[model samples]
Target chain A: MKPFDRLTTSACALPLASIDTDQLIPARFMKRSRADGYGQFLLHDMRFDETGAPRPDFPLNADAAKRAEVLVTRRNFGAGSSREAAVYALVDFGFRCVIAPSFGDIFASNAVNNGLLPAKVSEADAEEILGLIETTGAAVTVDLHDCLIRFGNRNYSFTIDPIWQTKLLNGWDDLDLTLSLSGDIGRFEQRDQAERPWARLPDRPD
Target chain B: MTATRQPQTLFDKVWDAHVVTRREDGAELLFIDRHLVHEGSFHAFNKLKEKRAKVRRPDLTIGVADHYVPTRTRALSEVAPDIAGMIRQLDDNCRANAIRMFGFDDPRQGIVHVIGPEQGLTLPGLTMVCGDSHTSTHGAFGALAFGIGASEVAHVLLTQTLWQKRPKRMRITVDGATAPGITAKDIALSIIARIGADGAQGHAIEYAGSAIRALTMEGRLTLCNLSIESGARCGMIAPDETTFAYVRGRPLAPAGDVLDGAIAAWRELTSDADAAFDRAVLLDGKDIAPTVTWGISPEDALPIGASVPDPAAMDDASRASHVREALDYMGLAPGQALDTIRIDRVFIGSCTNSRIEDLRAAASVLAGRTARVPGLVSPGSHLVKQQAEQEGLDRIFIAAGLDWVGPGCSMCVGMNGDLVPSGERCASTTNRNFKGRQGPGARTHLMSPAMVAAAAIAGHLTDVRPLLRSAS
Candidate 1:
């Protein structure tokens, strides 16, 4: 995964609420391998009609949004499904960051692990950013180091888990950080075996 | 002087007991008691292969072939190659890891969430993780269960632990008694409708009050299965007699004196009287009616007697536009009566409502009555199928012209060959009402099994109460 320290790029506005994972990348497209790029299938249903014709009215299809690396949407973005393929679609489609008032819990975690920033700003800040991006096709800078987003002379501080921020800045996945605590994990397991024997399942033959 | 003991919510007790280590950054390493995986876990297994890693605790992990397995037949030769390959991958991965798996021919094989509890793999005060979102269904047993992504699945496979931040607690109390027709599905829909889609965002909800306590273990599972639809981290109920009775005598559950000891420990898995929650919501169970989703989001629900909501009547511009978009996708008119809307088919299966109790509820409604439209009845598990058959439920469904098939998340996910036709609307017992969740361009109206059966008889969305009244 690529390190996500800072990115200044053209941004697009979806201006919708509760954009779920099924909408992000429909379930039908999930059968394909990730190695086969999911870029074409990102928002597949919304991007195209039943006949597979691209809907010109969609914001992402507009000329200004064609090269956008940032997406500004409303709250509960990527709301349903725990499919990591949703984040894979976003990253594969060249989106480095998604700015929303809030995000689905699992989606946020998947985003960070894939080096795609889930920048959570206040509702008002998200509305402001969406308006600016939709109206002016603004160039937004998402700075992970400062935990801030800047566009149109306005700076909005975003909220992210501190550990996630650190991981994003360092390009480190959870396994990288977790493996460092191997000793502590082992000690806890031994103690837990004594304290909560019922919690542990007996070993079964394969 | 002794330090005062802090009163803890049921979620707190379960979560705190599993914490292996806590970081200053607010992340805690939680030891996963049970890890359930389905065919979709191939991605995680692939990641493991790439890293040359082995599952840390094979004993704690179990696999099942459900998502991509064919429900019509267990024969791989008759299944689509891609779908067959997916099921094969899970079987091979489990074998490589020395993990127990309920594969295609296994009688215990079912939807991951359904069989977890059925096989007694899900228990009280445990931390369970799965690759599917509906994994929260296991929280019905007072367990701290939630879904994880592929990368997180691989993390658990390698370390037998997960890193998570503690979520705030929300208590939803349903006080009054519900009417006969108001099933757990109705109560769940009412709660989601009351609180918008993101109402419980970032919180772990503990369901309490008389109505909740009265629900059977199957009903509790149905209720918790939809928790993710409301953006809740998880939904749980305090383990009680119902939970203990349900867990008893199951294959994987403790037996004899060990069972007695386990029950004693499980009995203590409840919120202290003085425990405080971050938020509290109160609802009258008597107010809950047979409900259905009229739009894409699960929150776009209403009682059967109500009409579709007009976006123009909404105060918030964002919410209004969302409603408008949903209405457009669903092909629904603003003022149209929900009961008058016609459905092309009906489905009585899913992790949410495919247990024996759910099947019996649907079968009772469908008995001696022919369905007006085509439908399918896939049980939650093969065992459930056998039980339903023994009860003559399969004969009733077949007599009514609705196909009775094997179980494996058939039409609920449409991962297998079973899919609702494009542009067709289906009255279903599945949890999601999202666009194309049943299939591409397929519209889903989520409701209870009884409600779905009623719709199959009426060929549209109709109130199930009157049907139940007449049936009785």
Candidate 2:
């Protein structure tokens, strides 16, 4: 994962709200191994008809939006199941950042862990940015360090939790963070061994 | 003199109790009290096997083969290879890890969420995690429970702790009494409809007020089960005597003095009277009708008698466009009555609304009536099924021409070959109504079990209030 400073890329606008996880990557596609990329199955039902033909009118299938790196949508994006495949689909399909008014709690957490920034802006700002994209076909610039989005001479700042910003900027693995707290964790284990005996590790009976 | 102020909430107490340590960035290493596993556990188990890391607390973990196991009693040879292999992998992994498992053939086997509470494994004031989102169902026991990703699942397996940031607290108060024909499912749907999918984002909701207090244990579970669908990771209800009595004497519950001591601690888990929430939302219980979803999103629900929303009448541009898209996908007209829509099938099973009480509601509506369309009824657990049979509810369902099958998350996810065909519409008791959620090109209308049973008999959406009135 590269350290995200700033990037300007072509944007694709999906103006819908409450884009759920099941719609991002349906459960039928979740059975396979994660190593197998989920790019082709991104929005499989919405992107294609029942007979496996692409719906040309879908924004992602449109010729102008083919190589988009930034995906913009409305509030509560990724609102349903907690399938990480939803993030896999977006990232694997070359989407680096999702700009929304808000995000599903688990989905936002997963995005940060995978180095995908879930940028939160006001609903009015989101609508304005999306409007610019539709009218001018202009690309947007996302500056992580400055916490701002640039579109056609206007700058819209976004907010992200500081801890998540740190994790995303450094691309730090969560397990590594947990390992860094080993001293405190070990102390807690010792205290808990006496305080809550039933929660002890059953494998090591000692 | 110094003044003291602490806005104590139930979530605050449970969260503060489990912090192993806090980081400067406001993140904390929270200890897990219990872990539930199902077929989705295969991914985490594979990671564990690859790293050769054994489960840290095998006794604290419970495994079951749900999600992909077929509800129909068919030979293994007849099952799809991928589904069968997934179940086999779970069996082998649980055996090698020394984790207790309720396999597909075991009499105790059921949906992970259902069996946990029934077996007294989901106790009060505990932090629980599972790989599936509906794990919030266990929060009905006054616990802080939510879902985790595969990576987090593996982390919990290697070490019984997870790194998490504390979420804001929100209290959803439902005052006044509910009218007749209304159930817990209706209250949940009404709340979601009132508060859009993003209404509770970044908050853990604590359900309170008189209406919530009057609900049974099963009703509380049903309410919490859909918390995830509303964009909140968890929902909880404070434990009382109703909760205590249901948990006592269960197979895994503590005995005698230990039980007495545990109950005393749970009694103190409620929020203080002066506790201020980060945000609060209120609903009148009497205002909520038998609700139903006419669109792809759970938040797209409305009262049973309401007509499909006309996008032209909506003042908000975004909402209007959304309603239009939903109408196109659901094959509905703007002014059409929800109760006039026809359905091709019915399904009554899921982590949400598959308990014994849910079954009884459906049975009461189908006692002497016959199903006008094909439908299936899968119990949440083997215990629920046995109890339903003992009460002769199974006979009523079978007599009504509905398929009474074994326990699993059968048609809810449509992964086990129990799917509605393409272009067909179904009245489902599941939590989600995402496009093609039941199957490719299949349409789903979300409703309560009683409403679903009524639709199954009428071959179209019909208000259950009339049926309830007649039954009484």
How displaced is residue B35 in candidate 1, in Å? 0.6
lDDT of 2 by residue, B1-472 (tens): 2358575899988898899988888898898888888887777887787877788778778888889989887466679898898888888888889888888888888999999899888888889999888988988989999988777888888888998988888999999999987899999999899888788888899999999999999999999998987788999999999999998887777667777878888898899899889989999989989899999899999888999999999899989988898888899999999999999999999999899999999999998999999889999999999999999999999999989998898889888889989889999999999888898878999999999999998999989988887888
The most accurate candidate by DockQ is 1
RMSD of 2: 2.2
DockQ of each: 0.67, 0.54
Q: Against the true structure, what is model 1's DockQ?
A: 0.67
Off by over 4 Å in 2: A63-66, A196-206, B1-7
Clashing pairs in 1: none
Task: Point out the worst 10-residue segment of candidate 1 chain A by lDDT.
Answer: A197-206
lDDT, candidate 1, A1-206, per-residue tens: 78988999999899888889988988767777678888888999889988999999998788877689999999889988999999999999889999999899899989998999999999899888888876777789999989899997889999987888988888977897788888888898899877667676655643
Q: What is the C-alpha lDDT profile of model 2 across A1-206, one tens digit per residue? A: 66667889999998888888888998888887777888889988889987899998888898766688899999889888878889889989988899999998888887886788999999999999899988998978998888999987999999999888888888777776676676777687778666654333234222
